[model samples]
Target chain A: MKLKGVQQTNWIGVGIFVLIVLIFPFVVTQSFLLNHATFTGIYVIVSLGLGLLMGYAGQISLGQAAFYGVGAYATAIMTTTYGLSPWIGLIFSIAIAALLAYIMGYTMARLSGYYLAMATLAFGIIVHSVLVEWRSVTLGASGFYGIPSINIFGYTITQGIPYYYFVWAFAIIGIIICLNIVHSRVGRALRSIHDSEIASSAMGVETGKYKTQIFVLSAIFAGVAGWLFAHMSYSISPSSFTLDASIIFLAMVVLGGSSSVWGAVLGTVLITMIQVTVHTLGEQFTFITSEFEHVVYGLILVLVIIFMPRGLFPTISSWLNNKMSQRSSETQEKKAS
Target chain B: MLEVKNVTKTFGGVVANKDVSFSFEEGQIVGLIGPNGAGKSTMFNMISAIFPPSEGEIIFRKQRIDKMPTNAMAPLGISRTFQNLQVFKNMTVVENVMVGRHIRTKTGTLRAALKLPGTKKEEVSAYDKAMEYIQFVGLQDLYDHLAGNLALGKLRLLELARALATEPKLLLLDEIAAGLNHKETKEMSNLIEKIRNNGTTVFVVEHDMDLVMSICDKIIVLDQGEKIAEGTPREIQSNQRVITAYLGAEVEKNAQ
Candidate 1:
């Protein structure tokens, strides 16, 4: 539906964002840089799902990587063990991830705020342990391999330039879906539930139903991201799907902006860049380790929470809005005089 | 028509509502009034299915709904505003009201994501309906404003409009005019009357004596979780029991 005064939406900011997504690969030529870019796209997809729970439904989840792992492993086991297409594996991924989410989200039907955060944290750890201990299926902690490259429309994306575009294409679709939801009745109900569960229930919004639905939807997004990452990396270990990855996903959503859809993408890009930078520095310095990456992420998360609590996109967007409006008003005055 | 038959609610050792039995005929502006700790809100909550009664049953349109969940209350033609405004602060005024139209609309997550044919049409109609109520509440100019930014009177009006958008058969106003000044209270009274005239049964829980007396066709009074008196406004005005309940008279009032 069209909001009456929605014509005043910041189109310039939207255009700039579009430009960034489009030119990112062309701007960054190195394969190492391109790999980070690909990861950014995947993280954006997963974090956008988190945004649905965190931003819209007002539920925080730290178990996204479990869903991500479920999706990736589904892709790995189905194609490698059962001899199935990754696309078919993709369908199984969604189904399994949805099942996992429903089973886990059942506990969250009445949970909220920090209690929910803890539940999801515990759930993430449980899924991580399963991924590790399930030696029969997951191939144990040795990490599964021989995962085939992703084939989109009869073509393989080797993560060169085509894979970058491929990952981003899905990211763009994820963005569109997130945007469409926030403008729809479903989005409104989730937001209303977030504002006040009592009032939403009073208004005949099945708050629990919406909460569970968003939880499942968020899992599906993480599953899909996990699908992409599994095929692209040709490998996925328990370490990749641990609580650290889940926390990183949460950090991206927070650092981007809580409720802003673009904030998901922005936050993912910023965090991914940070990861790449730290990894690059670690490679150069012999003593420095990947452990150093966690410290950087921790510092950034704390700083963002303290300073830009609402995240960068909303704050920066508002600043841009003020600047644009002030300039236009000044021009209008000049023309009148 | 709605009936509360011998409903009793106990919170731990405290009885919030005891054997509260009454019925409202269709199309009447009914008021539930009482002093502090009178269990007026507790009664409203039970009726709205915020919680089930400890004993007794509530029949809405002749269906037993004592166990229905709170969200089910709206679709069953029972919608209510809160004692405190619960308008979504992050949403625009129109969006806040649109949340009420949720039960009426049928756009699921997949359909909403795809923007299917029925979804957009339903959305447009919902938008038009939300606007009509926004205008009805005399808030047409602030339709796009954030609901939290509106003045107190307008916020109350927004809640009413949101409740109305549910297309309810019975509308419950919980202290709808609680914090308004005299002029705003009068406007709220008129709005309640207009809603009643528009064919939705209006049941108001209020402490504003003048506002309640001026608009309500029937007044039901509660005190200490029991039904104290039930009568027309004129009868309630002169009722000795009500007077004693309000003024703390030493002697018991004669019941006629």
Candidate 2:
């Protein structure tokens, strides 16, 4: 069998993960952690796309939260102002996000490294400013409210268990789709672009086109997550989609391992857990402040950059691979003796 | 068949390639030889459409391709290897070759992400074809190895396999034998002959005279951005201008 780009999926691990997700709500029965898990699921959808764009395609974007906000506002306005269904709002959210991403990425894809990062950063700030300044359309600083919950066949997805299941389903589907792309010929070409754009183009992989396409796709993912976030909370402010949020999305991918889909998901979960822990600790102790979260994140990013530059998942996986391979070789030698 | 018509490439004030021209027929191993800064690589870059020449036209299979985009060359049946090796270091050997099959495969990002049956079928064929090229270049054992782990000679062969995976009608090899030992160079020469026999036109730039003279059906000599001589190896060796350009006037006088 041709085992070039088609790596074997770890089905057993996936199965165990599915079981945990299915049983988690029943086992915990805590609304706080369940809500946090649901939010983690939504963020995973965004991080997966960012991982493909930054980690594999080698394009940096600091405007993902803008796409997320665009998705949220698209659904928020359509459902609230126009009296449309949440589903219709979701479609519009994804479409608008994708369109804006395409327009931005067409010109932005040509820039690399710090230039691209700064451009995207500026874009995020601009979007946030529009959300705040456009008082009539976006409701300004008061925030957009009255967004309806998703209704599926007479069942409403409320903030706790139902929302958790719904969000996790989308996250799982997102994982499959991202994994599919990463394991195919398209994945190879994207990675080729990451390594060397000139070489990629020479190999007949249109580097500019691929970069723009991935950027748009990532925006769409963020938009979908935004729609979910807007519906789940039923209110969103411009503050949520700030430059800091985009940086957090990037950090999630970078922390987990940008190259792998699961790494992005893991990174999102870990970051979310950290945030929740910090919040809980801050409430329980006077010494621990809200600002402590940023300090921890900064420290983690610095340590990750210094030590495990490839990110957490890849480093851990490679170590596991070495151990497994060594054990197999040892067993083979013993059998031969 | 490929044709270079009066190509002149000027970088700022310096003339890299001045009004130089040559053409070769299909299914032949052609060698381009020159001293340092003889504009051999510049000529190859022009043919491969890396950049447009200041004045010239490169016709490939009767199509004028001098002003085309670099990516356009692969679809027009042209592939090349860089002297410094530009293989994707993070990818596996077979995966790197699979990337070369990009022009041949039509599965886009959406279809691939969806895992469509058609894309899967195309991917399998590409993988099989990539493996065949890897085997052709004798890298079957290292097919799964990351390209970054390969040695210099192996990296060059991997690059060749990748170019071959493109299934180009014309292959441009830039300094393919520059760092190879005698045995490896001999193997590369044989491989070039084999590639020609298999109906792919081979264009090589080399400083290794023995490998070039033995394998090349025709040799073109360049000196100071101009074509000094073009003929069979024996004819090029006998040409006074070619000898003098390579060895200098004093060395030729001493030899005589």
Per-candidate Cα RMSD to the true structure, in Å, reads 2.6, 1.5
Compose the digit string of candidate 1's lDDT tens values, residues A1-111. Answer: 345832222446657766887898888788888877888888889999998889888888888998999999998999988989999999988999998888777777876
Candidate 2 chain A lDDT trough over 10 residues, lowest sum: A1-10
**What is candidate 1's CAPRI-style docking category based on DockQ?**
medium
Tens digits of per-residue lDDT, candidate 2, B177-234, equal 9899999999998898999999999999999999999999999999999999999999
Q: Pick the candidate with the highest TM-score.
A: 2
DockQ of each: 0.66, 0.74
Q: Runs in model 1 with CA error above 4 Å?
A: A5-19, A283-288, A322-337, B250-256
Query: What is the Cα-based lDDT of residue A215 in candidate 1?
Result: 87
For candidate 1, give the lDDT of residue B229.
97
CA lDDT, candidate 2, residue B230: 99
lDDT of 1 by residue, B181-238 (tens): 9999988898888999999999999999999999999999998899989999999999
Model 2 lDDT per residue over A32-119, tens place: 9999999999999999999988888787889889999999999999999899999999999999999988888888766666666777
lDDT of 1 at A209: 78
Q: What is the Å distance of residue A145 in model 1 from its true position?
A: 2.1
